[model samples]
Target: MPGFNSEVRKSLQKAFTALADHYGVPTERQHFVEGPPGKALADFAAHHRADVIVMGNAHRKGLGKWVGSTTEHVLNRVPCNIFAVMGAADQ
Candidate 1:
């Protein structure tokens, strides 16, 4: 299980690195955290006093609409700004 987790983490790191490069974000600014996405992200942002967080819409159905649990959770916990991008219309 630990090995599987490591492999998954490696894969995620690769993808994150590519995206960061594409966005012109430096490697020093990137952080790889463990634990639940919402809590981890919110805690990290809060601790670092992040100016803004850019995220993708979960596109949830019903009441949430485009907002998902993780995004909502982060929004509720974080004191920073968030820019949620809508997913593609076809998706």
Candidate 2:
């Protein structure tokens, strides 16, 4: 995190907060996690005993199925169900 951009981190946190607020979800539970995205999420879920994991899939078309993304990485790591929402182009 030595070179991490605080501005971008703040922007992403704001976005997450706004999105959660738009859906009437509490922003208090939102987190701007670091480390490997999938691992971070998986750890969070496990720590919180989350019943399900909802995540966006960002792997592009040409990327092989095994070519990793946060969604795929957490599939084998977490115990809960995963609901992946693919981006428009990914679909």
Candidate 3:
């Protein structure tokens, strides 16, 4: 499970890097937090005083109902509007 998590993190880093390069976006300030989803998000928002929360709406089925457990938790706990970017199929 640790190996799988590492692989996923690596893949996400590579993808984010590519995206930043392609869009000319800076990644120097990017931060990744691994913790209780709701608390993590709330902490980030409180510390940064972020005006909005942007998240992906992965349309998973079965036991993975809702946007995602973490995302749902953040949405409920955070004191700001959420901007969910759904996949094409979600439409």
RMSD of each: 2.5, 2.6, 3.9
lDDT comparing candidate 3 with the true structure: 0.74
lDDT of all predictions, in order shown? 0.83, 0.75, 0.74
Ranking by lDDT: 1, 2, 3
Write one digit per residue (lDDT tens) for candidate 2, span 24-89: 886677666777687888898898888998777665666543344777778888899998776676
Residue 57 Cα positional deviation in candidate 3, in Å, after optimal superposition? 0.6
Q: Pick the candidate with the highest lDDT.
A: 1
**Model 1, global lDDT:** 0.83
Model 1 C-alpha lDDT per residue in residues 1-91, reported as the tens digit of each score: 2345777888988898898899998889877777788998999999999999888876567767656788889999998898888788516
RMSD versus native structure for model 1: 2.5
* Clash numbers, per candidate: 0, 0, 0
Weakest lDDT window of 10 consecutive positions for candidate 2? 59-68
lDDT per residue (tens digit) for residues 51-85 in model 3: 89988777888645446776878777777888877
Compute the lDDT of residue 72 as modeled in candidate 1.
Answer: 89
Best by TM-score: 1
lDDT at residue 57 of model 1 (Cα atoms): 76
How close to the true structure is residue 86 of candidate 3, measured as C-alpha lDDT? 71
Score candidate 3 by TM-score against the native.
0.63
